[model samples]
Target: MINSDEILKKLAIESNIRQEEIPDIDLYMDQVIQLFDSKFMKSLRNEEEKVLTKTMINNYAKGKLFIPIKNKKYSKEHIMLISMIYQLKGALSINDIKAILAPVNERIEKENFDLESFYSTLIELQQKNINNITDQIKIQEHEIEMLENDDQLKQILFISALSNMSNAFRKAAEILVDDLLENNKKKGDK
Candidate 1:
């Protein structure tokens, strides 16, 4: 039942931000939904693009890719999840990605994970991952250098995407809550 304006007001009050300073919550909501439509279609990278061969597309159609979503258009949540999948496409097998994301899906569904804290923790983890790469380079570790690079890059990109997705959801939620409060206030005055 959440909507955009309520989300905006909550964010404003919670963050001690002026109402005018907040972006348009409804517009943000639209952007969030559209984010998936534009982004998910571009899921396949140049290397992974080839993997979308006829057989692979057929496999996708046949549910080999675990199409939890049936509609051609997907929601922000769906896009966020798919983004994670795309990130793993290069490093992990399809089954492996599914296994890795299983716990995440469960956690999100069960509300076991705090979205805000998760985003913050991911940034810290990304920093740690970078530090590990730097330490390796400083030690003149040439072995697995390519792997280190790929790992670091993937971690950075994945965390960045996750952070953005979290923000989108948070903003949308805040706006929705704010709108409800405003409506209630107006009704009380009437």
Candidate 2:
């Protein structure tokens, strides 16, 4: 039997996947390939073209489609799986692909083949991402509030000063007009 490391190295070279990208290559070789080559992966691609790029591989890994083998690195199974996903990207969303790969990843990660328990963790992870997004929104809202309040204060102060200047100008113009009218009347009478 070919060793797991050899399989992973081969997969890396063939699929353009980096060795470092396959997180846990040493411990579980069979499960790694199995997760990658699941029925979902196969259905996603055409049989003739089967290699994937580093981006696809990383997406799959992060999406929970494939668990990194613990110790061994490369294998034909991993290559075939990536090939399948590459084929699928044409029609599938990253989230859709992740959903399809979820069960397979769960099984591999557990090493025991049970899937029921892993769903809980997946939900938790999703919730955590949501919380993080919400927190960022809250911080942005607070910053906007501060900026808006400061702008309003500045506008109020500016308007008050402008109004006072306008009133003074109006009073001065009225007094000047009255003085000119009185002098004209006196000259007419004389």
Candidate 3:
């Protein structure tokens, strides 16, 4: 059986690119790829998994997932947005991500948005939530351990419970995304 402590430690060690880690200057596509690879490689399940490829970056640019780049280079805000898209991709479709980030992109273009402060706040909130998540995991582990089942069965049950929770969260996120898109469309029509 996998220990809860081990799971918590793994969660703690998972990569989260701090605001300070991002370079102040704009980066070329190749440099962006290298940065992502270095920061996210440990989070990948296998060594063969690519973090961000040129094609993916190009597609994101074409798809308007982030603001347009200049001189074939990406800025700090671009990297932050790409990192957000990468995380959201695990639970949301690319279209969903685009819809959700539309307002943020618009703000960046139209207003003097403080993306650095926003990103820093987001990272701090995420770090704070880890304790809450680990607590939930510990509670779930205790519940699973109480059941009189074989070790394999217990593991399966634990995974199934986690999957159900993940599905619920994903559905909620999708609903919120839909609502935001609908509201945006309404505002556009006005």
Candidate 4:
């Protein structure tokens, strides 16, 4: 059986695409897809597990999760927005993303926000939290190891725990996101 620790180790080594790696110039649709896909290739489970796709991009725009495109190209800000949407969409709904990004998007469109700076700051904070993330994973691995007496049942119990934990995590995020949206709306009403 493949240990959960091994899996976590592999995930830790897989780095996400950094802001500096993103091209400064606006890119065509295909180029954008290729850039993300190639950069995230090592992290992908398989070729069929796409990092990004033209269809998904189009759907994001149609769903209003993405801001307006400039002419026929996607700017760096657009790239960052799309990237954020892509990650969020894995564990969140389109409505949730729309709610979360609405205020930030407004500031960007109003020329009061700088996407690059925002992205850099977010990256910095995320990096700061990496140790905590790794620590949590290690804690989980330790818990999994403690189940060694369960023999073949250990993996099943670990996976079930993961499922329950994911549901709990999602529920918490949904509630907090809804609360934030409500607070923002109340503030806007004033």
lDDT of each: 0.44, 0.48, 0.88, 0.79
Per-candidate TM equals 0.36, 0.29, 0.93, 0.88
Q: Positional deviation of 10 in candidate 2, in angstroms?
A: 28
Candidate 2 regions off by >4 Å? 1-51, 111-190
Q: How many residue pairs clash in each candidate?
A: 17, 18, 0, 0
Q: Where does candidate 4 stray beyond 4 Å?
A: 12-14
Model 2 scores a C-alpha lDDT of 0.48
What TM-score would candidate 1 get against the native?
0.36
3 or 4, greater by TM-score: 3
What does candidate 3 score in Cα RMSD to the true structure? 1.5
Best-fitting candidate, scored by lDDT: 3
In the range 9-128, model 2's lDDT, one tens digit per residue, is 433323222333344533244544444544234333356753333455556766656566334454433443454455345445565555555546556556675433343354355456
TM-score for predicted model 2 compared with the true structure? 0.29
Model with the higher lDDT, candidate 1 or 2: 2
Task: Report the poorest 10 consecutive residues by lDDT, candidate 4.
Answer: 8-17
TM-score of 3: 0.93
Query: Which model, 2 or 3, shows the larger lDDT?
Result: 3
Q: Residue 146 deviation, candidate 2, in Å?
A: 70
Instruction: Give candidates' CA RMSD values in order.
Output: 18.7, 32.1, 1.5, 2.0
Deviation in Å, model 3, residue 119 alpha carbon: 1.4
* TM-score-sorted candidate list, best first: 3, 4, 1, 2
Residues 26-109 of candidate 1: C-alpha lDDT, one tens digit per residue: 323344334433433333334343322335333433543433544444333443444445445644556555555555665766
Top candidate when judged by TM-score against the true structure: 3
